[model samples]
Target: MRRDLASNIADVPAIAPAVQSAAADGAAIDTKGFSSLAFLVNTGAIVGSGDFGVKLQESDSSGSGFTDVAADQVDTTAPATLTATSSYKLGYRGNKRFVRLALAKTGGTSIALGAIAVLGHPDHAPVA
Candidate 1:
């Protein structure tokens, strides 16, 4: 009888599929998931000459609405140049969820944009 009971239990199907379906229906995957999200400012509409600075705001405006994750200083000299390359790694805790890149200019002059790329595991893995 015990042997038969053990075999029956082993044959039982798991309910994992139901749980996974629930997770998919409720929670939305962010960059922490297999895919990542990013934005670029090339038109120079956000920043221009004599601009104090530029703030990269998260498009999602909710509880933690757009926060100033990063900023860049503009160099105000002849042939104004971007003081530094503005790049920021955004994530919660120790995990790097997303990467943001922007340019800062002192004067109204267009600058060549730096190539931005994203790389990571094909599967959803926590940023180490």
Candidate 2:
């Protein structure tokens, strides 16, 4: 049997919890030593009605050119109706070296949320 322990993974902040009323880009996670990544989203308050989606972007450079990852590449799609005080996630399996998550919003008040990037399957063990 095999198991993936904490030592095998690296956790990075994708975004911090805030009252977000506008579109924002999350942290650009570098996947040099790791081979896999996942974005975990925590949402709070539903003051806004249609802030239910986040786009996964990737690029060769960490600073720019982060366009949305293809729909088929992501493991999960954020629900159409986002619930208050709930959690969501999206997995990354593309070949890009850098990746990030961008919150998508339209004509709304504010939604409190944040995210974290979990990187796993390191090229070498112990993910230091």
Candidate 3:
């Protein structure tokens, strides 16, 4: 197997153990030292019927504010019956110093989600 290096530009203290149950903005993640972000989602439990969405967001003032990046949103394929082994991935290009994942759950009885955000560092420094 091929090996690759990973970086956490968001600087989160730890990976989010549980995803938001309702529609809400998540904690800000610092992306100062990286150029890209990858969001990995693992659903451990899901019940009832409802759709779920995860979107990429950005902030310019650290964690004080954030705005959704509509083009980078990801949605669950099976809203009615989410499988425990289901996984999803979203990618974002480096644009701001801070970034985050926004969660939106609708009409679901119960669901448990785990997410880990990873940042990718450029192989070479920017030339200007």
The TM-score between candidate 1 and the true structure equals: 0.28
Query: What tens-digit string does per-residue lDDT give for candidate 1 at 1-128?
Result: 23332222211111111101011111111343433333222222222333212223332422333333432321112122332333322222212343222233345433323222233333423333
Predicted candidate 2, C-alpha RMSD: 2.0
TM-scores across all candidates?
0.28, 0.91, 0.70
- In model 3, which regions exceed 4 Å deviation? 1-15, 72-84, 122-128
All candidates in order of lDDT, best leading: 2, 3, 1
The segments of candidate 2 whose C-alpha lies over 4 angstroms from its true place after superposition are: 1-4, 48-50
In model 3, the Cα lDDT at residue 126 comes to: 35
Worst 10 residues of 1 by lDDT: 19-28
Please, what are the lDDT tens digits per residue for candidate 3 over residues 20-122? 4666665676766666667776676666654566677877876576877656343333333345658776676647777777767666765677677766664
Best of the two (2, 3) by lDDT: 2
User: In angstroms, how far off is 58's CA in candidate 3?
Assistant: 0.8
Which should have the higher TM-score, number 2 or number 3?
2
lDDT of 1 at 91: 25
